[model samples]
Target chain A: MTKYKINLILALVFHLKLISQNFNFDSDIKISEEFRYFFNDPSFQGQEDFFPSYSLTPKFNIKFNDNNIIFRGFFRHDKDIRRTHVDLREFYYQTSISQYDFSIGYHQVFWGVVESNNLVDIINQNDAVESPFGNDKLGQPLSKFTYSSKNTGIFSFFLMPFHRKIVFPGKKARFRFPVVLNRNFIKYEKNNKKLKKDFAFRWNHYFDIVDIGLSYFNGNGREPIFNRNTFMAFYPMISQFGLDLQLTFETFLFKFEGIKRTADLQSFYAQVVGLEYTLNNVNGNGLDIGMISEYSYDDRGALAVNSLQNDVFIGTRFNWNDFSGTSLLVGLLSDIKYNSQSFSCDFSRRFKEVYKINLEFQYFLNIDSRELLLPFFINDHFFKIELSQFF
Target chain B: MKKIIVILLLIQTLNLFSQSNEKLGFEIAQKAVLMDQGFKSLSTKLKMTLKNRNGQTSERLLENKILEQVEDGDFSLIIFNTPKDVKGTATLTYTHKIGPDDQWLFLPAVNRVKRISSSNKSGPFMGSEFSFEDLASAELEKYSYKFIAEKDEFKIVEAYPVDEKSGYSKRVVYYNSKKNYRVEKVEFYDRKGDHLKTLRYEKFNLYKEKFWRADVFIMKNHQTNKETVLEFSDWNFDVNFSRDDFTQEALKKAGN
Candidate 1:
């Protein structure tokens, strides 16, 4: 405790010294209006056939010498539950001196190589309410230390003293589970709570055409087990080892991500491997076309909580490489063990410099009972459109 | 015997003249590259304006950092500044004189740095008339050259890219022979050996009393009737950039 107090005093003095110096600052804001229309009525009575919402994200940054402080926030207003919430996307102070760097605050870190699904990226929880596609992330509060080796690789250590619990979408949400898990019935291990200390270490390097990363995380697992009948969720303590690799050769990129974990509830292994290849100037035009194929596997197969167990993903991407930055991606994900298939299309373009338009479509051709909420998603096929303005 | 000797002498003179032209062309290219050495590092911002056939225009802004490697190739990083949706995106490239370059792109929204194929760099950059190949540092060994002509203050050279994957079949370059051998104009021929585009460099800046860099580049495509103008600013040679700043770890912070 005495040492901790001394460190704090020293850090305070350091900050005070920089406080008198000149600082450069800048800020940006993004406002987006989103509307989603479901082709069919939601299976649940409380859900809606269409959902509309808006979000605002504001970011501010300040820098002096090699030190930087950044703050970013996300706020959304929706007619549905769970969708209307505020999140701290990032609030951190970072500085780099020579071969070492340090940062401490709430942040988001993504760690994976495969595009279809990520099994090794466990640093941030999914902001499910923001997007059912699972790209939105909730910031994690942690302290990070990074060191670059002269001839080896980069090493990073993270200390997370608190866990941000995942929130389930409210009953009125379009893609909500049949029943919402009651907080009163949720279960946690004896020492499990928000204060659970988590630690993670990762080492990554680029060797010519190949890049590889290895990581170890010891703490509560980010993905929880659902007690379907009990209408509850359980958090388990687990240790996970992850590896991600990518090889770029010619016009092709090969990717792989895998993780093995030992948990109080159960132990399992999961992996995802994929490749993307681009054909530039396909027909003497500026347009470029690409293809992506990935395979995901889990030890628990259909029983896995993650929707991608034993699944194959195929996607096609078209890039106009034009002035307006128009791009489109159409993908299909299917589970071999359960025979579930989901097709999606994403399109985005920029216009008028500061504005962008995005469109997305999701359709479920079939859903196996083993896929959990996917069966109810047949009625959730929807089209979404978003317009964003940046300043 | 006298007539035969005269013919032999004439042939010998022609052969020597052709050989000298080739040798002079290569020598001028070497001089151009050598004069810019020892700058160590450079940082600049580029404002790119693209004009379509319809006479409409769009603009993009990006910042660039280049680290010169004495023995190998230069490492360059470009961070996009504007065109709104692409703001905060960054791309890094390691270019070699003889082979394909290595490239990586950083997407700020996801905070992900992904390695991308560099072979496709021959495509247009930001839908502009300039392709990635057009913007790369002119390495002496990447092309084979022959002297075309010397008119007034400039000497012209015709060159062919050694990497067959290049978008152009040939290029005619004109350099100001009186001043630092700086490139003045270039004409590019497409893969079909048809005239494609022409680039003109104007308004040169001399930095550190040794390096001469062009402040403006205008490229016009004949077939597409498209034009692109690039203006460079904020030229800084001493930001203390190191190899460490070019790594994947540093790419994550490039947006900031």
Candidate 2:
């Protein structure tokens, strides 16, 4: 059975574990200034159209005698009081002994192969105050052990003793619903406590043209369902099995990610599948353009926490192949059932050696009647411009 | 009578060498490859400067780690060090002998690794005159060659790329026969066999008393009037590197 195969591989990983020694030290810092503007007036009371913010991120690393210590910090000052905060993104120590590596502290890792939405990535909780799309995550505190086999695959195990809850935008924020949720009212299904320990395992392998990963996770669900009347969030306990795969050949790349979960309340699945084809040297020029199309499906339907359920995404990415590393990505998502639509455009360019300018625009139109995603209270369309200096 | 005898011997050797020009070219290339083999592993830092037609220049800094595979092509990892905007960004490449190479790009901000298709070799690399195909053609088996000419210390050979995706139709290499067959210069011809670019290798250093590496490389684009100067420094071969150091898991750790 599959369980036997997994057990056998786990045993082999512990037995066939190798040696490396090196020393390196590095440091990096970035300061970013940003301005954001909203398209429409506030749908709620005491909301503003323009806001400004600044942030500083610093990272320091040291590697000595096969052991590495890494530290990263994020601090921000924003006009919105809810967005102003300080966080330790990473502070970890990892060491290698032969083929085995062990690490402990706050860390972050991403899973899944889809470009539009990643349903299989469930390790970290969303920092919705920073980005509603869940592109940003708070660092997780955990301990991990990995066994890497030369010819077979890579096996990894994680143990997390604490859980971080989602942080939503406050009442004055543009994306907030008409009714504000009280954080103190949040409840957990398992003994009404957030200290539940979680565990995960993953097996990743590469075979010439394809790369695949199989993972299992038993943890507190990162997504929560809310009670409309009392404005309370209930976190559920979930057991999930996930698969992510990618096949790359010539100029074509195919990616697929799927996850099946059984929670304390219900059972459901979600999937993202897509293909990307790159056309290099277009018209004898150095410009490279990639065409992408993907579909997202979620069995949770009305209860889904993301807007990508039952939606189709079409996108184009352009790389000018210039010295500045200029790139532009534009995409549109259209709902199949509700006929709602959303568009996003991101453009970034580096200049003057260590400085970069980024522009982002996002718009939502024809919201679903049930409001599966953004709330109906605020005009969520916005554009943001950022100038960053790195040292 | 002795001079006449020496002249005859020299003429006889030259005739024998020219009998099969293709075979002679192959032998010269194979010998060079063999001379540079058995390096085991290498690590170095690289500084690249790009000069535009208007006389402006920009610089990029990166570190390179190479693991020599006996049967397949080498496995290389490139980590960007400066232009701090891209710091901690790394790329892993597993070049093969038969199929296309496997390449991945690691993004540090998101902690994500994306497998990218390596079929677009002809496109320019970071706006530099050198294309990805140009950087990949250093292997002896990637091209077929023919002897063009032989002079005092230089042996000229014409090499045709084996990959259909190559941007150049032919490349002419001038090897320094006196310096263990080290390449001194190369001239590239475009798809129409038009003169495209010229590259010169300078300041060669002998490493491990067996391998010859050029410290300075200058590539000039004839059509675009642009140039790139690549400098290699701090070559370290004493450190140990394992195959496990180049995998996706390692990339994530390295990104951090």
Candidate 3:
């Protein structure tokens, strides 16, 4: 342990030396505490978790003449399933030369327009233990080269080396499926050596009122197929093609995202189409309300996880446009084939200059037995509040 | 008969003078827009303080970079630098002279760029007293100018929004009558013709002896009794920027 600590300090010093060579440097640190109140008791024993969790993240950025570097790290200690862990969210060196931009190291890429599901955002693995909603992702290591044109479109290519696997909540956690995911017993459809070298490409352009993107990816699938009891996680070799489109009119936004993936076990297609319409300054009170609706469909029937075979999502976002920076979003997702449904609400407000407060609540209702992973999360509905201070 | 003829001639002269005055108002507005052009690019740091009716205050820091389009409206980027929650957020706007502007917002938390279709341009900017329309670079064709009055050293001009979608009925702009022709103040009237807001430009500093910029701008909303003060500093007009710097892909990296 002493040697490990010494080595860690040495590595940090080396990184500091590399950063000091830059011209201008800026850094920010944030600390947050989250408290969750579970209205429902854990269905099983030993599942009762602590009420509070803590997280600390420090971000650093440096600019060297024409080159830029940014690094962010996250460290969290929780009483529930994840326990304690540290992750490197982003550490990349980027530069733009002429019409091309390049970045090498750990990074994240977000693609697609549909709000309900991001079918084309498959470059990074999900950090499921961070949030039950699956909106968090682990950092991915890749070398990216992008070309942007004034009149045409932007094309980006990524050569990714190494794959990060998704982690699930432990048995002692709440709001998770009953099956305990064993990270050790992972399976790969192809040899690890071959799967390590993955490639992805995307082209995005805007024409008049419409914005569109086409993406192609060949890599180990981000989602793992799990079997019962042993939690046999299988990372299959897959190839995917994706299309995302958005059309913005006067006060309405139309969006669509679709993907076709071929894997070792099954070939499936999925799509989500949505629209958002805003009523600005309703009643002349500086309140803007946006209504959103989306429909999701997957061809893989009940075989797919999360019961996303067919679903409809409806949500509303309200912006007070006040000095407090108040905003609220409420959404609901219902399974078309089953009676399972999920309702969530997120409200946030900025306090003064350095602090922000957020309240989030999610409830899963009427879980049909036919829905996959429903049995374990029967008592996972809860409300959480968090405060973050930035320095 | 001689007296009547003299009166008719007087009326004719008055009519011609009024017509010329209207033409002069348009010419002055056009001249102001033209004089401020050819700067090529400008980058500045801004600090905005928003105060409500109850005197509660909040502040946000932003960095703005503008690249002048040779033939069209300007392309600009605004990056939020302070106010912890909003830090790392940025917005890119491409303003057009003939039509509505294109705007995209980058949210750091989600790491996604959202295309906002806000053609109305009347929404408050970041909950401040200033509206989105006010933040955009002024274009001469957007409004029709009519000479209102001359108060001391300032020439007041009334500008009517030509676009039917404008939330305001008209705007009254005050310009410095001097050769510099910089804006001095502005007053906005709502759709119902009520006085909505008043903006005052203070502490003018001439850069390179040709370009004029205000060091302080204060916008006061009449209806809500709220005010926003924008203080600008660290103006750099020579830092060269290209079209590549204004793309949506560059927004995420703009925090640096």
Candidate 4:
């Protein structure tokens, strides 16, 4: 074992001894099931009319003394015209010490992004078309260590070394393992009037709202450019600098974030900026409205072979507490240059605890006429219904 | 004919207006309480993964059963899969959901079941980072609530725990107005009634047109400075279970 591991083990042993004398150990379990259906447009070719997906996820958690641990595993089975069987989704362990904490195994790590639209998140496994861009691969191991200094500030470092596999339909893909690292440091000032207490170095604040970060990676996971003979070379060295800012005045909440990524070549640099604002109470009935927007620019100050892509989105939500508590949400996304549009709506109703029901609808428009643009603009409609009971 | 049609339209409009007055928050809390009352027994499969400080990981799987009777607040039996240390372990609680949810654990290694006091409920469950409070069914009636605001799609409410010994003193809940029974966000308060954590629910789905469940639940604890994100899928409810399944003999027979 490494020195760090030895130290950790010793500390754990000491703590466990103390806990066994004063506290007791306990355990719990949770089980869940999910069913999904997908309908594709027949005109799109090689599309299926109905695709059903099911998953069973069981979770177990335990605690001793002041220390706690969690473990969860996910299994997915899909029945479409093509595939059927159980696929392992995720398995990981997480634990914490005084000011230090760690997680390892097949886990998901989310960092620096508005809805995970930025480049910092690497463990995203969402397959929904509405989800932001991210990669999900198995066999990737991630570790994160964090420290806090009470009233001063907080800092954390995250590292991951793993093999990334990219498989295309009907073809064997490529695989590469690389080392990735991310570091974040944040400081807060006292705002007694707005907050109950002055800003202090704490894990919850530091991990949830990272103010400053530096990220870098070295890997050879580039997609093959020409039939496994040629590969597109990405700058082996990439670094990003970013910050998150929040402003709260009266009942209004405003948030702004920006991130910049630099590569060896000027053309490969990327920058993203995002802003959101929510106004409380428009009319009576407690109606509030909010707007969110983000913009990304790539290939700045460098020669580029393709045109720059821009994306913009806006949405609003309305809630009514009366009438058994009902909620409604609608959002729209538009690719200005490509003239593509996506719209979604969600509605829910809670009847006295016996049952609750929710419905969602989404539509994606395919506007690209060129075959090259089809990959990014496959239009489709999606719908889902969910019901749950408390017992 | 025209006069009758106009009268019927007026009555329908009146009914809609009356229905709109019932707040979403109130409905959700009411439903939450009802759901907690319907269960007589439960059976589930559990998988646990442990990650040590050194990054080594291990996983284990087991089956669980619980038999409950609410009239006397008696937990007849709780059983676990058979294993040398764990098999045939059954617990019977004389009084649960009262002052202290009394519990007992029967360990095959000792050939006896041990009583668990109220103080022990705060301990971790298994080797995971969850506590007994997290495992227990939250009683909606245990808290009093006030409607705070109605946003574009949800009604936000604040609930104050009536039980002094409850883990949290206060909570803020956001409910979907259209569905009138879904929770979007829940903010938990510490013993001092200070905001300590926030739990957000997303990806709501309607199952069997009777229930609405969130696919993801992210809990951020402020006091301890930790976060737990639960992404749940494949939810099957109403599976048949019996009191015999929760017996110690059955647990031992199953082999933990």
Candidate 5:
């Protein structure tokens, strides 16, 4: 108990130092706390079980001249699991000289326009313990260099020296795998002693009507293959090639992203094509409505782990464009093969200037026994609410 | 024969007078664009107050950066500084002489830069009466002008958008008859040919002995019963801006 108390005091002092040290530099800081409660217990848990969690995140940013540095930390405590964990979402230093820019440390990069899922984006590893959905990611450490020109395309090169493994929830947590994963039993295809550096390159350009991006990646795959016998995660060596294109017209935006990957377990291709159209000022009351539709395809069929072989997604976004900045999005994803479907709604609004709230609800309907995601479907539904205050 | 000759001369003189008025009106519009040229760049702070029909008011603060181009329209950046919900949000715009302008928005919460499609230009800006197109610097080629009449010290002129998709069908501008040729008031008509809004400018300030700026500008929406008033101050010109400052990547740091 004494040791824990001392640690807490040290953390408080460190945070105060960071806030006071930016006197001569331009800085921005925000601290937020959130609480999440689940209404239903997992099928594997007893009826008396309860699931609730709380977290605190602090983000710090400082800039000088052309250089920028950012650091974000997350600390969470779960009541049911009775465990505490700390994670670093991002810590990076970036600078630019002339037309060349460089960044080193941990960061996250997102790409793709499809609303259903990400087909080509693979820069960061997923933080599965944070959310049931795969939108959150754990920051990856790397050195990135880029050169941009007006006439020519922007070229980027990434050199990652270390690979971080994924983390799963504890046995008492909900929405987790049926079997508790043993991190000690995990296997790596590459030698741990040797510097098995990963490499990637991308080129992006924009024209009057269309924008294009081409990328090639040779590294450890983000998705882990679970060995049923050992209950362990195995990351294999993989090489991937991806292409993304977007065409912007008057009121329509068409987007497409496709990727082909070769891995130790299987080699396959996947693609997502979609478009979004907006009805501006629908009633001339400062309101806008946007409709989005997309189709996802994977050549692996039933062999796909996520079971997203053939699926269709339809969604609509409403922007009130009012003083509170209220927006709501509702989407449905339906599987063509098994007839399984999932519905989700996301709503967010700002109360005044400093306070905001976000609400998300997800429900899964109909599960075929042959589906690979049957375990997740058993626990079918969850709702989450987050209220944040910015400083 | 003398009476017929006098009537023929009168008709010819009226035709010449109308022709010169058209030429003079266009020349004056062109002069307004030229007078504001060679400013190199400008930086200013903005305070905006919005009021609803119930008389409730909200305020916002912003910083603006503008860089004049050699041949293109202009490059400008706007960063929200207050209303903590939107603080550190920035937008970078590259206005062009023709075709659609390029716009990008940076969201600090998501740490993402999104390329906004050109169609959203007609949408209101930050829930204010001013649309995105209204806040942008006016380009002469984007609209065609015609002189309507002269009243007192103001010249009334009508302008129409070249693009049919524009939100406004036509706008009547009241230009100051002074040599500076500043805009005093504007009346906006919606695409359905209904008068939608009116803007009034006040407290004109002359800078560099050549550029004219309005310290107070108010926009009243007749349909929505809401109004927005913008006050500008702390004007700084020629702040040594470069093309690098206008890029999408630079938008993340624009708030600083």
Candidate 6:
């Protein structure tokens, strides 16, 4: 005890000396506002009219030396005022020492590709019902550490040994509806504790142009709802493994990933591949083309028929200097097997140093069994506008 | 005797002109960098407005302070103000001549400050268009230069980067013939040997009749499609700043 106390005191003194000797501070404040409205057909549950959602995210970042001690908060107000919510999106303190970097508090950890659904990134399970694009909150506070080296590679480890409040579908209900409630506490007992851990290793030897990585995690597949305490205590254990590889040659880049999950004597897997190429010289304008496909298989094939999922997307973006301030992107997402397609276009313009504007339009056609398991078909459209300023 | 005197005078004037022009462009290039350096301490309040698509706007106000000392190279402190949660954070940077610079950030909430790696120096600074390399003090030895244009009272020279990691492959600077110092403008070239950006200095003011400071500087990035306007006012030089002022303890106490 005495030795530990002495070490603590010395450490405190050393830090104090370092702080007193080299003090510097800088801060940047960023605020963003987004407005989105979607129109759905009668086949969907929601009304056909416009429904607006607005969010304001404010971020303040501070650092001492090379560590980041950031505090972020967000407030969202929808046309449905009754559902307004204020959230602490990010409240993390991160720092690095030698080859090690770590972060604590509520934060987002993005590790892989596939923006909407990252099979390789399993740390934070997201809300599936909130937004189809998975834009709603998906991360939670935990502890994370990374050991990285430019000459060698990187190794990372993460752990979340605790649970927090969550919302889930209610039990014994005629209609499927989500209910907000605290997670069951009885499971915290020493004998019933559930510990979640994730590990990843990445190597980039081809001049940072080619990257390969492997990741593994052991945890519950998603947030859980209580099941008569007895059944809940027997939660199924899940094991997931993934591999990622990316290559950049000259102006062309390629990325590929595969993930597999094993649980309850069953197995599922997904694979993704993407490619992007830049036009060598077309008045300095660059063009990128990308495609993504996802497949899933259940060894048992008992729960859902077909047990296979596939999605493909194609996009094109154009930038011109004469318009020095304008950019446009158009893309299409389709389930070829189901004959369903969705098209989206986004355009942005900067008026000056003080003002910028963006508009997005999306339309979905023939969304049948490919959307959800339901046989219903409908047409939907969404329009979103955003304005921002930098001072 | 008259002919000899005229010839000598002409030679002397030409020699002075050549010397003045030789260092002028280089000095201006150096001055553009030096004016922002060697501050014992500094504090500022700034407001940022972001304009995004869809016609929505957001703004934030912040206050910051910096303390600097030239030891071996550079040792400094940076502090941020606003959003009480991050009020007492600081960052320290130390540059080395042989290798890369070392950095550290201290967080009051965590009660710890950690060192930064060298690889990250090429990354963006706080999501802005500026990179870490743009923030470092540029040493004279980091580049080689040659006079490309010599006009009546000004000289233009091109500088090539010696540091392999520098964001710009080359830079062109314009200097004044009379001062043997002061850069009027700089054009930066990207790694692909293309003109990438230009920095223009204006509103020059003489400090202590020895130092020339430009009150306004505009940096435009062509590739990233962004620009930054830096306006400096209320200048103070050679202020009393001690080594203790740059320490971590000083940072916590000096919180804005």
Q: Which candidate number would show the highest DockQ if scored against the true structure? A: 3
Segments in model 6 whose C-alpha atoms lie over 4 Å from true places: A1-37, A44-48, A61-68, A79-86, A114-117, A162-206, A223-236, A279-308, A319-327, A348-358, A368-377, A386-391, B1-256
- Identify the candidate with maximal TM-score: 1
Sliding window of 10 residues with minimal summed lDDT for model 5 chain B:
B247-256
The digit string of per-residue lDDT tens for model 1 on B1-256 reads: 9999999999999999988888988887888788878888889999999998999888888999998886767888899989867778998887887777878899888888788888875788888898878888778888888898999999898888888778989999998878888899999999899999999999998888878889999999999899999999999998767888787777777786
Please, what are the lDDT tens digits per residue for candidate 3 over residues A1-391? 9999999999999878776765788899999999887888887777764568989989998897668888988888888647466888889998878778899988877998877788889898878788856577888999999998757778999999888876767777786655565665577778876666789999998886888999999988887776655656688888999999999997899999999999878799998999999988775656889999999899977666656779999999999887778999999999888888989999999886788899999888778777666667878888899999999
Candidate 2 structure quality by residue, lDDT tens digits, B1-256:
9999999999998888775788888878877777778887899999989999998999988888888887888888888877788787888888886668988889998888888898897899777887887766267778898888999999999888888888889999998888888888999999999999999999999988888999998999998899999899999886578898888877776666
Candidate 4 local lDDT, A1-391, one digit each (tens)? 5999999999999987887785533332322223333454433344444434444434444555434444444444443311222323334454545445555555443344343144343333232221222133333445655554423334555555543333222111001011111111111122223322101111212221223434443222211111112322221233444444433332233344454544444214444456655543344223445555665455432122122245565667664423234668787766556665667777777554234566767766654443222343253365666553322
Question: Considering DockQ, where higher is better, how would the candidates rank from best to worst?
Answer: 3, 1, 2, 5, 6, 4
- Estimate, for each residue in A1-391, the C-alpha lDDT of model 5 and write its tens digit: 9999999999999876765674334334444444554565566643224445566666676765567787877776765342356777778898889778899988777665566777778888777677757577778899999887656757889998878776756666666566655554456776667636788898876787777889989988777665445645677789999998878786788989899999878789999999889888776665889999988889887656567789888999999787778899999988888868888899989876777888888777766666664555456376777777766
TM-scores of chain B, in order: 0.92, 0.89, 0.91, 0.63, 0.89, 0.69
**lDDT tens readout by residue for model 6, A1-391:** 9999999999999998887565544444434456666555333343334445555556566666647666666565655332355656567777767556787877554445432235565565443323334345544677777665535555667776543333332231111222322236324322344355333333322233455667887765542322432434223356778876656553345666677877764467676666645442144322222232333323323232221246566666654322224567777776645676768888877554345677888776656553332233244366778775533
Q: Score the docking of each candidate (DockQ).
A: 0.60, 0.53, 0.62, 0.02, 0.44, 0.05
**In model 5, which regions exceed 4 Å deviation?**
A1-41, A46-52, A80-84, A182-186, A226-232, B1-24, B252-256
Candidate 4's TM-score reads: 0.45
TM-score of each: 0.93, 0.91, 0.92, 0.45, 0.88, 0.56
Q: What does candidate 5 score on TM? A: 0.88
Q: What is the TM-score of chain A alone in each candidate?
A: 0.92, 0.91, 0.91, 0.64, 0.87, 0.73
Task: For model 3, name the residue pairs that clash.
Answer: none
Ranking according to TM-score, highest score first = 1, 3, 2, 5, 6, 4
- Comparing 3 and 6 on TM-score, the stronger one: 3
Superposition error at B200 for model 4 (Å): 30
Residue B183 displacement in candidate 3 (angstroms): 0.8
Reference-based TM-score, model 6: 0.56
lDDT of 1 at A187: 59
